[model samples]
Target: MDVVKYLQRAGYTTVQKSFYAKIAEWESWYIGNVRKFHRYRIYNGKSYVSCRRLGMGMAKKLSEDIADLLLNEKVQITIQDSSTHEFVTQVLNDNNFWVMGNDYQERKAYTGTVAYIPYLDAVRVSENGEIVDGGTVRINYVSAEDIYPLSWSNGYISECAFVFYKTVETKLYAQIQIHKLQNDQYVIENHVVECTNGAGREVPSEKWKDLKDFSGLSEWVETGASERQFVVDRLNIVNNYSKDNPMGIAIFANSIDILQGLDTIYDSYINEFVLGKKRIFVAPELLYTDPLGNPAFDPNDVTFYQLPEDTLKDGGKPITEIDMNLRADAHEKGINDNLNFLSVKCGFGQNHYRFDNGSVQTATQIISENSDMFRALKKHEIVLQSVLEELIRIIARLGQKMNIPTDPDSKMVIDFDDSIIEDKQAERSTDRTDMSMGILRHEEYRAKWYGETLEEARKNLPEQNQVIE
Candidate 1:
């Protein structure tokens, strides 16, 4: 089969197109220089045309700033049961979920949508013809367009397909997984196709594999897994701005106009510096004449022009150098204004970014707690917290299905560390003052100050009292 035919038979053409569009948006922001800068043609009444442009990568800068601010560090994951905690911790460490979660959040910021797929690896049947643990649970992430939910209801995906590409020995292959409900069973169909030059041939493989169905599972009844193996993360949605679908908006989408204006102004400034304000002017009489008696000068000629006093008497002016900083101040102001607009539009608040003295610096003098910047951070954190909790639940359900000794009903807690930007010592002092006034407990103080949980803080309470004594 041809690759085109494979795609046609694969179905969900509209979904694939939407996914590519979302990918293009992400690439435009992350890869940089996707949006070409406009070059201005400078005509100084001369035959020479000077083309100049200054392309500042605003999309890349804004997206990276927000990603770093939101997910620079690993999030804290806590489980309720001690045994379940150990199992969950081991599973997360084995799968590197901390790093994956950080990347997922960042991808959400850039692509506006992302997903977590929890799947069993190396599954096999036992000698008794029963499903048993054969491998560790694994979790992977996918961007928005690559995942297509066939049906959605009450915030749950009933059926879906995930399309991805793989390379084996320089040959490209398309791997499609369709997860659906069949006979009250959770079935997944894996299809592999060799794609070359818009043609595809389906690679032969086993058809359908059944996962543990929740209808008869005790873990599903106790825990709220819903037998889901996939979770879709939609971020920064403003009217589903991309298409009629749930394609989310990019973080820096609103700042594009300001960025373009900045680029235009910067390009004009460079051109003015090179051709408009700074130039070499020489008297036409001082230049050598051509065969047609036309006044001409060789730009490459190193010969010096000998201007005599008699030339001045004949109304000839000597060679003069012209240099002026035209619109230099305006250009600086315009660039800074655009940077501020871009920062605020991306939820960094005003004055969060500043370009001064030929360098960029974030404002360090102001307290962000009372500003809109902190509010924006909190808003993003709320979404991230929920996403992480759902991801943990999916992982716990996988453990349960594997028959691993784990607590399926264990809840996860996410602790975000925002003290890097704010004055954490000041917060600690306030907590201390509250504790001294009998409004706060020593355990609560330890949890807030040392980034420990209430359990961990309680364990340290006796040691703290002994040290104080």
Candidate 2:
């Protein structure tokens, strides 16, 4: 199908004309530069000018223009091999090009939340060979923190965050900075603690002051993990921290995993509570028999049984250490992703994965067959939820302290090392994985609005908030 004709059916006229004009110029420019028989598109029996007569600059410029026009909003190009199910979608924007839908599935649906920001200046690929018009590129920020307690509780429960973490890029400025290096469960053995030795006077930022020896030294552990990172960075560099210990004040540097892990726990808790089967919705006759044959017997369903109120358990050590350790390992997949990027910047890092099969599987098996194990699991879950809440609170405080006075609406530019910027820009770009942006945005709004409304409602209801006084 003619690209313009196909796009014309989809709509847009001026956009099509612009592309045709550019395509003609490209054919002519190529003929003049390459001194070859210029093959041109036959439209109304017209021979387009050959580009062989034109200079190399004109040909090269035309080539760029042709590439740009391919992505112009007017040309909705769909490229697919007769042999393959994959098709790539590219859309040209005012200043960038975006390609998406290079996944297992041949088709991809974009609701709007999906922004295909290129990793700076790299080309995006598609299952189909053609580039869609008005393709916008995406930019990915290498982050240090995307999860919490990388070595410990890698999840959160019963939590609601009113923050804009979803669309907000994980770049340094866009990210929530934890500069204070607060202590979490995983302790770093070597850390740098500071204290003014002379007069306990606070030092101002702009002024240069005479410094004596410092106090408040703390121990933090700096493992040479980054030295063993897997891949290379855009700078053609690898993580190379060979030191057995990096300087630090805490046992471990508060990592991105802590925040991300907290979110997981919160989400998991909410899922078990809110996504359970509804007794009222279940038909009385079919409730006893379902086709999937795996309807969870939810205790919360009043119609199912006269379920007793959940009782609090006595404080005891977590018995599911093996399971917990495995869970932490399994959750580190994303954590390791950011770590890999960081390793390229600072040095290499020893990667860890959240183990999913062994202990977690065993615990699930035991809890499924034995009621006692189930109760213990429930108790552990409750404790885990409580612990996660405390962690969030601590992080929140650290976040507050870390917040520096800066414009919330500031446009920040990340400067890469000029030596490697060219190569980095040439690397392959990644497409945003999120597609159902509308639903996710809606969910985000609902969560935000729901939390605010609930908070306001509670403020007005002394009966609910009386404990505050």
- Kindly list the per-residue Cα lDDT of model 2 for residues 36-123, writing each as its tens digit: 3322232356665532111212222222322232222332221122111111121122223333211100010000011111211222
TM-score against truth, every candidate: 0.76, 0.14
lDDT of 1 by residue, 1-469 (tens): 2322344576633343545555675556455444444444556787757454566666666666666666656456667567767877887788877677667666767677778787666665443323555477777678765666666654446667776776655667666766666556565656776666645666554321221211121111111233556777766446344444544557765555776787777666667666654555665556768889765777565443445546666776667665665777777888799888877777777887776765567776644543777887788777667766777777777777777667666654567777655787787788889989989988788766665667766777876452232
Question: How well does candidate 1 score on lDDT at residue 342?
Answer: 79
Worst 10 residues of 2 by lDDT: 104-113
Give residue 331's error in model 1 in angstroms. 0.6
Steric collisions counted per model: 5, 81
TM-score of 1: 0.76
lDDT (Cα, 0-100) at 239 in candidate 1: 30
